[model samples]
Target: MSDPNDWDFFVGLGLALSSNLFIGSSFIIKKKALLTLQQYGVRAGAGGHGYLRQWLWWAGLITMGVGESANFVAYAFAPAAVVTPLGALSIVITAILSSKYLNERLNILGKIGCILCILGSTVILLHVPKSEEVENFEDFIIKIQNFGFISYVFILIILNIYIAFYYGPAHGKDNLIVYIILCSTIGSLTVMSCKGLGLALKDTIYRKKILTTMILQVSTTLTTSVS
Candidate 1:
């Protein structure tokens, strides 16, 4: 990864925020489409594929794709620590939009949850490093190979396996946290992999270094798969 200057950091921040906006709105669009589809066809939960026929659903899907692409690109320009925490903003956006567009009421708990998300993002933002630590893909590789990072990933994988297989089948439906933990653990690995891949892509584009990019891409893919 190149050293991200102030302009690059701000651009990354903008991309992250824009991604959240698109992703958050996509939930509402897709939900509204599903609700509308239910009036004419079977519910998707009952194995209906009727949503494919709805333009709103397609629009939402495309919007989500754009958001995800933006997020991936943001990793190239900013540290993952900075970009990842900002994802919480999506929850706040979704909650607000749900109340306004979906007729969903934000109870006290939901309101509290939104407030907490904002506060958490704010705290992380206030404390995040002004500059990224890794100046290049080689540095990223070294960091990922560190003992602490390896140990953490190992623990995450074990916890995910235990929760997904042992506890999930029994309590996942009733207890959301089990699945949340599973997803969060897996998502952490995915995000890190994404960051490496993003850096490789940027380096390839700007530096025209295909061989290093290939190696970095393969390394990231293998790391995520291992996790």
Candidate 2:
């Protein structure tokens, strides 16, 4: 079922990595921009009208959507076997952008941390076998080849339990923009974590193919606020 026009392994991996990394960083970038816009007095309560008046959130979301959608298209043209591994570039992109654009600090330890993140993710994703990948799961259970994946899944379940039970009550409520921005980072972490689970499980395919067919799923949800 392979296409003659399909991208070679290296090219496809590069594109997928580029896509995931860019899309992931753009999440936090928009979060930061939203936080900034609130400082300029955009009320989330005003919804669409409030957001349009601010402009920064609008611009940030637009830019991020384009970057995100492009990856879906790119990955659609390639196999997920070659795509998911490359998406590990998210940690790299996030670290660099946080430092250079967000003024988050480029200290020695931070640099080392980012390098380690990129290096570790790269090794796991690249060396991991596509054949060993789960590809997709049926029902609520994932047929896993690794106990490491089982442990991670358990941990995620616990984390989700805690978030669902405690996070909101503990945080004591915040400004709408600040909360959404914070939640955006949280959402990215949740997604990257899920992707990490997939990687840990060596998943190679998506039932929905967000990197392909559902490119607009998340970012588009953000955009529909205006449309």
Candidate 3:
């Protein structure tokens, strides 16, 4: 584990979490898209451009699958602690890709946020925490409480009502867009976490190659010694 050569931990953590990061992002975008369609009065039991939607969904799933596979491989080679924080680079990834493909503009504020996120993630990874086998529901509840869950829930309910009213008589695509984004964020997080858990529980291989490499790296040596 101390060796620069042993990159297994980092690789594993990175692979799994990166998959999560991408999956989460894709879901977020996809959700927004579906919401637009909903605004078009196409909810459940409807088929118009349904073929296009299906195609888009499948494409997203395929991309997600490739991401997940790479994540699994990373997990096999590195530690989750090492890999997850690298996911902080996701915003950067999105910004660049979006700029190139979608012609989205990334302002200075966004650039700063992306940098900070990456910095924070790198800090977290340097610490190299051991992966917890299970989430502590108690801790989860406490954290939610600290974040003012009651207030959040209240606001969410209010938003739902507003959306309902706003979209009435004639549905507005905006509401659907917002709703889809919310759903996607939740769904992607859930699915990716589940996949990561499933892989973490299985027998692992390909770790030696990583560990060996890590040990040889001077930074890792210094980093481990100081830690």
Candidate 4:
């Protein structure tokens, strides 16, 4: 039989590609739904969650969820270096969908840009290094408990809380940048936790079972929620 690791690598590649397709299509669907909502109700930037009532929006959200789930599974089986860059496929997909469905004109320059994105993504995929050596779940716990990482997580948590509670209600409504900053801040931490969680789960399933993996997954999930 072929090596199990090789099997996992191919599986992850397939899942990542599938995720890109679904997520890319979801963007167009959601945008259409948003446009429809804008015509019928208040805009989202003005405290309107009316998009929730749009069936297209819900469909798009469901599609996106499936994509994200595939992405999570891909992470469990492949290195971040391999899986992350594959997300560029979604950009290409979205561009194509936008031109087709939204009647958005793709200028010559835009076409070149899309081609360049595809070329870059192809190069990255072709040259991506193998997945890193698997480590014990205890090693992850030690890394997470390190003083520097702990302090970083603490700071992110405090900042997120401050922004959500104090600054959000006051300036977030008018200042679009504030919301972007808030989301970006939390997003960084969430990405880190997800990487760690993926590795832990991967090790637990494929290697020796470790109780710490489950614990780490739960804790990281909670941290993601907080973020």
Local accuracy of candidate 4 as per-residue lDDT tens digits, 116-205: 878987897788755555444566567777899889879988988888899988999799988898877776666556667777777768
Count of steric clashes across candidates, in order = 1, 2, 36, 0
lDDT for model 4 comes to 0.80
User: Can you write out model 1's per-residue Cα lDDT over 1-227, one digit (the tens) per residue?
Assistant: 66547767878888998999999988999999999999999999999999998999999999998998898889888788889989989889999999999989988998999999899888987888767887567777889889999999899878888887899999998999888888778888888888888877787788877744454766577555744
After best superposition, candidate 4 residue 60: deviation in angstroms?
Answer: 0.6
Worst 10 residues of 1 by lDDT: 210-219
Tell me the whole-model lDDT of each prediction, alpha carbons only: 0.84, 0.52, 0.52, 0.80
> TM-scores for all candidates?
0.86, 0.45, 0.43, 0.70
Q: Could you tell me the TM-score of candidate 2?
A: 0.45
lDDT of 3 by residue, 1-227 (tens): 37543444555665766676676566545544555566765654465555255555566666767775665456434544555456556557767666665557878999899889778876876775555432332333344345565575567566666655664325655357766645444443333333333343333232221223221243233323422
Q: How close is candidate 4 to the true structure, as a TM-score?
A: 0.70
Measured by TM-score, the strongest candidate is 1
